[model samples]
Target: MSALGVVGGVLQPLLVAAGAPLLVGVMRQVRARLEGRAGPGVGQPWRDLRKLLRKEAITPRGTSEVFRLAPLVLVATTLVVAVVVPFVTTDSALDPVADLFAVVALLALGTVAVALAGLDTGTAFGGMGASREMTIIALVEPTLLVAIFALSVRVGSTNLASIVASTLHDPARVISPVSLLAAVALIVVIVAETGRLPVDNPATHLELTMVHEAMVLEYAGPDLALVELASAMRLTVFLGLLANLFLPWGIATTATALAVLGGVLAFALKVTLLGAVLAVGEVFLAKLRLFRVPELLAGSFLLALLAVAASFFLA
Candidate 1:
């Protein structure tokens, strides 16, 4: 890799970590506009992070060390995942260790850590949220894996960079029915995994309706900020994968300076459009009852399975 390419790889995760909260802010603004209400500015999430960082951490009396360490683990895990996923191009520096399966495993590890921390707080709400989160992960993860497998089968590898490269080599892959179905499955997975509408409401402070927020209720100060930022990063990572993998029209395959710039611009445009679509979906759909979550995930699973089968048979 050239010096610029090396520098770009080093900066990739930081850019993703920073871009995530901004993405969430933009989605909120879009949703507000769609609902005919005044919206917070796109920089709102940044302000929140700054404020949270300046506050003091207040640990629950009954909490264990896991509670204090969870945020750090969460943030680190998310950064690792961000590095693994190719946003602007298919030549990530971490590609050797950034297999699609490894990415999923790291995500699961973070999820488990956060869930255990939630239970460690000894709060009924926290435990309940943890239970709900585990349930959702159990249902959603398989769908995510299967959808990825659909793409992997077509490319003959489980590496995200390879998959993106292969897709770029054959532009016609974008319009395949299997690709479309996988995209749909991934969208549903994104909404559910990111704690968005019809799955969990990020805006809600109500304990009964909160999944992610409830789990982090005891976290404060920088710890809270880390957890929140990690959640935002998770959203960005998923959307980036969805965009770059399925519709990687403008992504850079070469290490040229001009290609890198174009790739960055293309990445921004794809993420912006995806965020807007998510915001619109949230505005139109009501949050599903917690019990109904299983049904929604089940539908996604079936679609993903069909997608995999179709790709195997057709692509």
Candidate 2:
């Protein structure tokens, strides 16, 4: 691996893992400010995780190792994506394996692991949450794949680094019909995948409406902390991908220290801005009914399809 790749591989995951909680805190604080409420401070998530780590570990009766391992798998998959994706630099450590399909499959594996963990619990809420999560994932994975695939079509490569590097070279493509449609499609799927507003509310714990929370209702202590941290990292990863793929202006093309530092700063600013925008928008939107979520995802898939068509016809 190149020196840039090695540096970025180490820096990117560390940044994502540490900053993920801060990102969540920022979103929550933004939403709270908009709604005229006193919000938990931006450090609150980090505080919560620290507290959870100190608590006693608990495993529910009758649960299998799936319940024990899902959190680790979820975190492991997200960290792998962080290391491989072109967030801090245009190059990545595992560049050869950074194919779009591989990254997407890694993400899907994490989702499946969590769902299986829910099923292993054998509780009514866990089963219901798993079923609902599966339903959402069925729609989400396709839109995500096709949407990113739309971008890959133009570059003639499925490797994510190549696509980002291509966009970095030709910035105008960001305004093309293909990019716009794919951006919208990606944003929708990111929302769904991260359990955000208008799909699944991160703050809601009402058994009747919660999707992600219900699945982890049986978890406590360190396992719960891992799940929560993994969820936050997934959000950061999705936002980082969305930002860098379409707006790769400040990413480092060189291996120099100054360039890499600038890239990291730019990445943080862009993702924070996007997170704030999402939070503000959520204040104005309500959760869609469970059955209607597929409709929204379907709409995103249609946009991605049109984008793919446009990429070919307009090329």
Candidate 3:
């Protein structure tokens, strides 16, 4: 990679780490306003995270090192993904590691770490949450991979930068049937992966119904802050990848200052619009019953399958 690419590696994660919470805050604010009340402002997540950072950490009486280390692993892996994805500039020193499979595996690493920590906690809620989260991961991963396959088949390269570069050079691909199908498949994976509505409620404390929250329920202080921030960064990274891959209109192809600035603006606008779309969706839909979630995920797999087929056939 060039020096410019090296610079991008340092800058991309900073973008994700600093800006991710704002996306969640925006979504929450939108959701609240839609319910006909004044909502927590867009800065709410940052404030909540700050509060968690100042509190005391409360570990359970009989937990192992896994419980203590899992949050760090989760946050670390997500930051790696944030830097590796072509969120700001397609040319990045990390491009060699930005393969579609690698990105998915990085995400899976965090999930696995968190799941093991959940099991390590020895709480019924933790076990229940781990079980549910794993189930969702199983269902979500195939669709995610296949959706990547659908997109990658077109360019013959699974590299995130290559995919974005291809899409950027050919703006018309955004509207193709394969792109549309893959987009649908990915949007479903995003909702599932992010613990958004119709899958898991991020704000709920209800024991039986919560998935992600249940796993992290025992965490406090900096650990909880890291976990929350990691969640936000992961969601933002996923959305950034989605926007850059499918609608790569303003993604910086080069490492130039002006181009990068434009890319940042484009990235913000796209994710903000997408977040609004998600919040609107949450308002209209109810969470699926636990038993019915497999059906929802299975449907996602089918959509991804169609996307792959369409990519091959349409070409």
Best by lDDT: 2
Report how far residue 48 has shifted in candidate 1, in Å: 0.9
* lDDT tens per residue, model 2, 272-291: 99999999999999999888
**lDDT of prediction 3:** 0.88
Candidate 2 segments whose C-alpha is farther than 4 A from its true place: none
Ranking by TM-score: 2, 3, 1
Worst lDDT 10-window in candidate 3: 2-11
What is the alpha-carbon RMSD of candidate 2 to the true structure? 0.6
TM-scores for all predictions: 0.96, 0.99, 0.97
- Candidate 3 lands at a TM-score of 0.97
Model 3 deviation from the true structure expressed as Cα RMSD, one decimal place: 1.1
Candidate 1, residues 1-315, lDDT tens digits: the string is 444435457666877887888998899899888878898899999999999999998999988899988888888888887766778767777766568889888888888889999999999989998999999999988999999889899888999888888889898988898888888999999999889999999898797799988899888999999999999888888898999988888887677878878878888789989998888888888989999999999999999999999987895
Pairs of residues clashing in candidate 1: none
lDDT of 1: 0.86
Q: Pick the candidate with the highest TM-score.
A: 2
Query: Residue 179 in model 1: shift from native, Å?
Result: 0.7
lDDT of each: 0.86, 0.95, 0.88
Candidate 1 lands at a TM-score of 0.96
The predicted structure with the larger lDDT, 1 or 2, is 2
User: Which 10 residues in a row give candidate 2 its minimum summed lDDT?
Assistant: 200-209
